[model samples]
Structure formats: structure tokens, C-alpha cells
Target: MGILSRILNRRADPPRQTRMLEGASGKRWPSTPAFGATGSEVLAGAAQVRGRARHLRFNDPTAANAAEILRTALVGYGATLTSGAEETDSAFADWAAAVHLGELEGEIIDSLATDGEALIILRTDDRGALRLQHVPAEQLDESYTVELGGGRYIAAGIEYDADDQPIAYHFRPARPTDQYQTFRAPIRVVAADVLHLFRRQGAGQTRGLSWFAPVILPLNELSQLQDALQVTAKIQAMMCGFLIDQNGGATSPLGDGESPLDVSLEPGTMRVLPSGWDVRFTTPQQMAQSVELVAVSLRQIAAGLQMPEFLLSGDMRGVNYSSARTALIQFRR
Candidate 1:
């Protein structure tokens, strides 16, 4: 009896120890723990940063340009829905058309490009017409949760079953853009009534990362450099030259060869130097290498977004027909 009990206890032993990550608060935990209600083990403090990136994609010029290019390229041609003899009539197509006004696919694709997901609410308005509203992912209450019969859950505004199927989505009762009437509870909608579209990268992945997430930092740096170059050029253009009396000569206002002596560097104004002073005009060096450097960064961004360089930069200087066709073919595929 003692030997049999020892064998049973040994069989019930837990698994061996594994590597762990130390949090900023000095708490050590496993990198991949068992699934919990919130599942914070995998995506600890990621949503806020992703939300900021979505905002930047709208305000940042480079991100906006890339997103726009993607939207136009991916959904420009539009798609056709075919029905067979056994299928129903054109009512479905007509209803979709009425809902989207000929830009259904484009809108959905735009949402994916910007937010990495799209929420579509299907309903009928007062006029009995099918109204399809595209809701921003930010509107979903990621922190909201409720206890029900099945088990405790981490709502994150979306409920999924064991098989990773979406069961329901909880939306904030108030519109994000609305400024008034702040008191409202969350509204839950079944999965059948709404379409939540996203590209899942893994078996248990739930949240979506913005398409611009990877290249955001690089794009912002590039934009800042370009802006600095423009500002430098503008300042150089606004001022012609400086009158300097390097030899400790007369410190009075100087005149140019043709114009009167002046101290200001305003537009259309030329300065003349004293006899002992010299007028030194800055020779602006051509940023011949900047074009190449900017192109390289853009290429990286394009690669990250799975976009072609020519499409984002609109540069065809060195692109021949063969190369352009090949690139387009690959991008299309």
C-alpha cells in the first residue's frame, strides 16, 4: 500500500521550472502562463501604446501617406460577389450596396489599414433601411467585464469561446466623439449582429496591432529630419549674407555693392559692408545624399508595410517598365 501511494504521488508531480520575466514592479512571473480571465500575462500594458499609435497614424504625415496608399492599392479595384442559380436573388448584394454606397470594401480595408481591425454594426434605422456603421476599435471598452453562467471573463469588450470564436462584443453606450451626457452603461451585442474583422497572427491572439506600429518611430524621425532640412533652407533663403568686421574695423551699418547699408535681413533687402568689413554669404551645400538616405528609410517603411517604394514615395526615376511591372505583380500577389 505504501509503495502504490508513492507511485501515485510521483505521477501527480507538477512540471519542471522554466524561465520567467521580472516585471518593472519587481514581480517575477512566467512569460507564458496559463490563460486567465484577463490574459495580462501576454499583453501587459500594450493597448494604451497601440491606441497612441492609432492616433499618430492619423496625425503623422508619413503614417497617413502609407495608410492611404495601402487603402487605395488594396481596395481600388473593388470585388465582385457572385451568386449561382441555387443561391438567393440579388437582394443581399443590393442591401450591401445600399449600406455602403459603393465603398463598402474600401471602408473596411481602410479600417484595417489604420486600426488593424474593423468593427461593423449592422442594423436598421428609422426609415427601415439597412444601416451599416463602421465603429472604431477604440470605442470598444477593453476594461469592461461581467460575470455570467459559463465562467469569469476578461471582456476587453469582446468575448470569445474556447475555440477562439467571437461570442459577443460590448460597446460603450456613449459615442466617443460626443461631449455631453457622460453617464451610460456598456451595451452588449451578439456576434451574429456585428462583424469584427481582423487578421489573427497566432492561435490564441485576440487584440490587433496597428499596421503602422512597426515603422512608426522610423517614420517620425524621417519626418523630423525632412522638416529640419526645409526650415534650414527657408532660413538660408530669407537671409542673403552677414556683414562681419573681423579685423576690428568700423562697427557701423554696412552697404552691399549696389544697395544702401542696412542691419536687417528682411526680404528684398541687401546689406553693404564697410570698407574694412567683408560680406560673407553662406554657400548652401546641396543635399545630394539626402535623397538617397530618405529613400532608404522609406524603403524600410515600405517593406514593413509590405508596400512598394514607388507607391509610397511616388518616385520613378530609376524604375523601368520591367521592374515596375514585377513590383506591381508581387505587391498584387
Candidate 2:
């Protein structure tokens, strides 16, 4: 092309615009991740995360109470039938009572909070009266995904059609850990026959992650720290420490000039060490007196779960009524 023609083409071209996010540039670029994980990776890792959360729920008071607090706030005392359909209401109440619906609701809430998901298997009695069963959400195997051609597929144990809406669920009748039942094939149930409860956070996400995911690591670390402190407290209480002999004694002062002594002391026991020897009790510091660090971890957990630190830790040291009220009002909203 002629120089004049090229100049005209260059003038017609759009201006160059280079865009780079601050977090994704220069020294930060390599560390700043562009996650390509599947949308349901949360579901994929649910079982292990659920197991840890359940352990905390059963054994850790803070974790257990977190779920309890949520359950109380969300489904306090269950629902009441006050619609004023006297005859119909009474019958509905009776049916609800027969199925223990009130308690069932609370349990379901607990499941969702603690397990990140819940399932209510709808059933009927011999006479065809409706009943409800609350089972572990893990009953639905998230690993059981399959393609069935024509846009019909099972993703995260849920069956979806061309439009990607759930029409059924596949689950194990027995716990996945049950060795005897491990060989049993998954049982498919229509979506209408089950109530799948979960806190959906992302679009096209087929499974729910346990609410504990954000705080699980911190809680576990805190638990370990507290445990270490407890053990340290026990050793500190009894003066259980190692003996350090500065004079390089052949044997422990408490032992004949043979192997080092294995001494056990009780309360109020008076003992003397060799003139050149001293006791260097193996008593470790109580978690470096990390009371504040522990409090900080609890706060992290509370923040992750969106609960008041006072509520989660039961520490009212700095909580005044006004502060608590302000926090709770925001929470209740």
C-alpha cells in the first residue's frame, strides 16, 4: 500500500487501551490467584469439611453454640398455625404434631448451619399419613456426577435437565462410611419427595458448603492452642520439669550414680537437688500467655460466621448493653 493509504488506515484504527487490575499486576500478579476451580468445588470438598465441622459441633462449645444460636434465631420455637381455620388448623396442627414438625425444623436448621446443607426425606406411615426424616446431607454423594447425553446430567448428586434445573437427587440409604452399605447403589428420588435446604451463594452452584468453612482452620488452631495450654497448666501445677545438672554429673542427683533418675513428686513434697544440679522443669509457657491471640481467633471465627464475638465466645468483658444491642440489631436485620 502507498504511504498515504497506510497513514489513513492508521488514523482509522482504535486507540490502544491496556487495562490491568492493581491486584493482578507487578509483584502481586504471581501470588494473586485467578481461580479456575469448578463452581461446585465447595461441594466437592464438603464431606471432609463437614466432618471437621461436625467434630467441632459435637466437641467444641463455641462451634456447637454457633449452630444453636443460629437455629434459635432462625426457627425459634418453630412455626405456629394461627390462620383461624379452626377445623382445618386443628387438623393441620395434629398432623404437624404427629410428624414432630417443630423439632424437625430446628434439626433441619442445625443441619444446614453445621453441615452446610440439609435434606428432609418425605415419607408416609402405614395408613398413608405423612412423616418426615432428617438425615445427614452427605447421604447425597457429591462425587456422583455423570453425563447422560442431551444436556441431561447428574451434577453433585442432583439430576438436572436441559435447562439445568434439579428434577431428582441420588443418595445413599446408608451413611457413606458404613462399610456394609458402601456397596449399595445410590437410590434416586424425585425432587418433590425431598426438601433440600442449603444457603446458595453462587449462581449455577449445585451444592452448599458448610458455614464452618471460613473459620474451620482458625477454630482448629485455637482448639490446639487451648489444649496445649491445658496440658501446660497441668505440668505447671505439679512442677513436672526436667533436671538440669550444670556440673555435668554422671547421673541424676535423685539416682545412684547410674542412669538419670525418674522422679515423681506429689503435692507439698520437699526435695533437694545436688549442689551442682538444678531442676529445669519441662513446663512450657502457657501458650505464651496468648489470651489476646485466642480472643483474636475467636473474633475471626465470629466475623467469618457473622455472629457477635460475645455470643460466640461468651466473653462479656467489653460488651455493654448499648454495644451488644447495636451489634444484635445489625445481626437480626
Candidate 3:
């Protein structure tokens, strides 16, 4: 058959059913922001996120407690390396004691949660026994990379083989703000000598982002709300004063007067105002529902933290035993 004749004889395919939003528009999805980020791409913000996370860890009690909670829940008192071979048992004990395994594990977990990754350099003692040196995550900048030609490549400070496996890591000098360090080349360490710990969020992702990424905004909101409420309470408390005119000659402070009379409210002491003088306080009532709102907000943060709300909040008023058990079971898993 000729080409034109064959084309005219082509079969007509039936249309398939499709499903989509019935009436989607900007009004329906007001802000549809999206990020097409790979694992390596996400590390671009890891440094900032890690800095904020660390700041919160130090200055904010809630954040500090959350890190502790995660450490406790995951590592607890840590594990013992006991296989029970005569010499092996003794060697394991010495190594564990030398490294302070329990404390080291907890620190590593905290680093993973706050810094998004734990950079531990493996070293050997004089006897060739293993040793570990924990380095700051900030020492490794994601911008560090080298194209090694062919399929092998160094990306985001990590060197990968042609098979796409990490072969080594390149770490910048300790002091990032130093001009000399900034200009210096990063130190390259083989993957075998370095232990990189992180919880990968996506497949083929080269690096991990802070676990707090999901909850940072919510946490900041909660912190700011609490601060606002605290300031309001303080203002109300400090302004709560009684006006007095012992001689009743000070006149009404609202009208033409020398100055507003200040009266102190002392404990276990009382002072009666003179006649024709009245005390009025500038007390402003705060929102009664603020407590409930905070509780609800904390629950939202708790969801992001992957823990039971009661555990995060220490509020067991509405938490039942069965519910607590279920939540803990899920968290433990």
C-alpha cells in the first residue's frame, strides 16, 4: 500500500476518561508555591535551617526540650557493645569507655535532628584501635563540588563513583568566615573514614535537611505568640496600680494636674486614701481563649515532631491511657 493510502486507513483510538479538579483557579488554591528540589538542591537551605535550629536549641526551652526528647526517645541511655567473647568483651568495653558511646550517640542524634547531618571522622589510636572525631556540619559547604570527568563526579562536597555511590567527602576548613579558609581547598576524606548520618527525605537525595524543616514556621509562630502574650501580661501587671491623694489636693490626674499619682500595692500592708480621692487602675483584660489557642498550636507542632501531643506539652488533661499507648507505640516504631 502507498504511504497516503496507509495513513488514511489508520484506526481512530477512543478517548479515555480523565479526572481533574472541576473548577480549579487561583481563588481555589491561593498560593501554590512549589519547589522542584533534589536531595542535593535542598541542602542549599540546610545551613540556614541548621543555624536557626541551633539558635532555637540554645535560646528556646521548648526547642531544647524537643531535641532532648528526640534524643531520649531514640537513643535513651544508649546500647552496650557486648558479644561476650573473653578478649573481645574487654576490648569493646575499653573502646566504648574511650569514645563515651552513650554520650556520643546522643550528640550524633541531636546533630542529625538539628544540623540535618552528622559529620564524624574516624581515626585510629596508637594501638590502631578505632577513634572518632565529631566535626561541625557547617565545615562542609554544599557549594563544594568537582566534576571528575566521565560518570564519576563530586557533588555537594561528596564524591560519587561512576555507579553513583559516594566514594569520599570534601570538607571546608573549620572557620567559614576566615578569608584564608574560604579561599583554601576543602580536605578530601574517603567515605570509609567518615560516618555521615542523616535521615534522607527522598530517593536519590545526596544530603538531608533538618527534621525541624517541617515545624520551623509553626515553632516560630508559637514562640512569637507566647512572647506577645507574656508582654501583654507584664504590661497589665505593671500598670495595675491604685491612685491616691493623701491630702486630696492632687486633683484628678486626668484633668489639669502636676502628675499622675503613683501608689504601690504592697503585701500585708494597707493604706487608706484620704476623702474625695479614688483609685482607678489601667488594667486591660487579655483574651481568655489564648490558653486554648496555644494548646491547639502546640498540638500542631507535636504532630510535626512525630510525638504524642501530651508528651510534647506535658498536658495530660485530655489524654487517655489507651490513646497515649497507641501514640507512643507509633512513635517507638
Candidate 4:
């Protein structure tokens, strides 16, 4: 009777609810970051963001200018490394010259500008000489992570110890086509042998956001609007006037039955019209505001990128020597 009573008193699991957290506005939001997205889902979104940022470097003028500004400030002439030990400094200098570290450093800076992160692999060649290889951040196997006994987690290629300190990196080797290929087992290396440079914003953030990520959407829309304005202006200039006959049954400009006239206008060209025919010109609104609009958009983008507006647009109109110098100094800071 005791055993039967114990079995009968056991409880079953409750049913799951669709609603999660309720905000002040009385709206329910999913109880998860990235809208309840899994780690793999977040990684997929990150991959798309990285690809868009890379393409914007070539396709978007504002992005190109921002990249150049960052490159110049961070590593225009390359960074110099100094060591307290004379012997170590001299030996490293020799190795740097052999590997063209000056040039490679500039490339690394460019990568950071476009991709938001750069990976450097410190390796020893067959002859025992140290070699450095640059790998894209996307190639890091974010899926190859583990959770330790404590509250620490390893998401992506990085492995953190119990104290949340990075201890190792897992990398998928590059393929012959220079594309990222998943390996059966990623190459695991100690954190000391790899340098992962990036700007971290949020606490516990695993990846960096692109430098131009903030202004990308607005800048792209502005660029498209400017292009449309320019095309409209050109079309208005080409179409001067249209000829229309007031009298009925007028002969068409093209020889025989009611054909439309095909004509090209040149600077010094002349055309003769019939007696009852008149040429009416179209008057489009003056687009002087367009110039100001473009300038304002450029200024906003430049401010976001921490660069001088004139430098981004290549226009020095109304900017005197003193103002230019002042802007440059402030931007440097």
C-alpha cells in the first residue's frame, strides 16, 4: 500500500508556453538574445555581415573612404615594435625585413578595417625560421566549441579556461581555391601562438563589428539618391523642348503616314517648324538643394568615421587653411 501510494503521487511535466517575456509596452519578446537564435544561427548572420562589409569596401564610396582613413591612421607606414632587450630587438628586426613585415602589417590593418578582425598564425618553417600567415576570421570554426565544467563557454574557434581566459584556437585550413573549407578536425593551437586583433565593445562579445557598420544603410541610400539626381539632371538638359502643331491634319516630320519625328539636339543645331507649329519648353525645378543634401550626408558619414569631410569628398571649397588644420588635428585625436 505504501509503494502504490508513492507511485500515484508522482507529478508530470508541465506544458510549454509560447509567450515569453512581457515588456513595459505589454508586448511579448522572446526570452533570448538574437531573438531566440541558436549559436549556429548567430554565426550564419555574422558570416553575411562580414561578406557585406567586404563588398562595401569596393562598392560603397563612403565605406572606401572610411577604410582608407582607418588604414592611414592605424598602419599607413606600418607600426614599429620596440623591445627592452637589444639582442631580441635586433634579431626580430632581421626577421621582419626578411618577411617584409612592413607590407604585411599594412595588409593586416586593411583586413581589420574591412572584416572587423584579423588572424595571424605564428609558425615555424621547415628551416626553423618563424613564419606568419594571415587567415580570414570567417574560417574560424565557431561550431567547434565546448562548454567547460564551470559557467564558461567556448563559442567558435576560441577555447576559454575556467576563468574565461582564452587558451586555444581551432582553425580550418584554407582550401586550394582560397575559400574556407571545413576540416574533419580543426587544427588546434595554443593561444600564445596566434594573434587575434579586434576591437571589442560589448562585454563577453565574441566578434567585432565592422568599422562602417553603423553608417552603412544610410550611406548606401544617400548614394543611390545622389546617382538618381544626377541622371535626372542629365536627362533634363538633353530634352530642351517639344514641337506641337495647333492646326489639325498637319503633316508629320517623318515622310509618309503619321510617323513620329526622331531628332538629336546639338549645341549649334537649327530646326525649321511649320507655320502653325510651336515649340514648348519644360521648366524643371532648380535642384540647388541637391548639392546641400549630398554635402550633409557626406558630413554625417565623415563624422561617424572620425574623418574630415573634405578628405572623404575630395572637396576643399570654403575650407581655409586654419579650419582644415583644425579639423585634421581634432580628427587625429
Query: What TM-score would each prediction reach against the true structure?
Result: 0.73, 0.77, 0.79, 0.75
Q: Compose the digit string of candidate 2's lDDT tens values, residues 1-333.
A: 999988877866679875567665667578666655546577667788989999999998788889888888788778778888898889888998888888989989988988888998898989999888887887787779899999999988899999988899998778545766454588999999988888877776677778999999998898998897778677677767777768675344665654455477778988877688777766455457577788899899999999998988988986798989898888766
Residue 320 lDDT in model 2?
96
RMSD for all candidates, in order, please. 9.9, 6.0, 7.9, 9.8
Clashes of each: 5, 4, 0, 1
Clashing pairs in 3: none
Candidate 2 Cα errors over 4 Å, as ranges: 1-20, 26-34, 175-180, 240-288
Q: Report the C-alpha lDDT of model 1 over 1-333, residue by residue, as the tens digit.
A: 699887877856678865454442233445645544334522443465566566767777777778778777777766546667434436766666666645877878777876777888888898887787888776677667555546535457787665556788888776557977464677888889898887665555566656776787888788887888889889988777777777786656643353445455657865455567777887777655776788899899889899888888888888897988898888877
Among these predictions, the greatest lDDT belongs to: 2
lDDT of each: 0.71, 0.82, 0.80, 0.76
lDDT of 4 at 71: 77
Q: Can you rank all candidates by lDDT, best first?
A: 2, 3, 4, 1
The total number of steric clashes, by the backbone 3 Å criterion, in model 4 comes to 1
* Candidate 3 root-mean-square deviation in Å: 7.9
| Local lDDT at 311 for model 3 | 79
**Weakest lDDT window of 10 consecutive positions for candidate 4:** 32-41
Give candidate 1 regions above 4 Å deviation: 1-51, 84-93, 124-131, 145-152, 161-165, 175-177, 180-183, 250-275
lDDT of 3 by residue, 1-333 (tens): 999998998879867766476445345565775566666457667778888888888887778888888888889777766686778888777778888988998999999888888999999989888888888786765887778989999878889999999999888766535555445578989999999888877777877788888888888888999999999888887876666666757545443443446445678866555466777777565456887889888889888988888878888886789988988887866
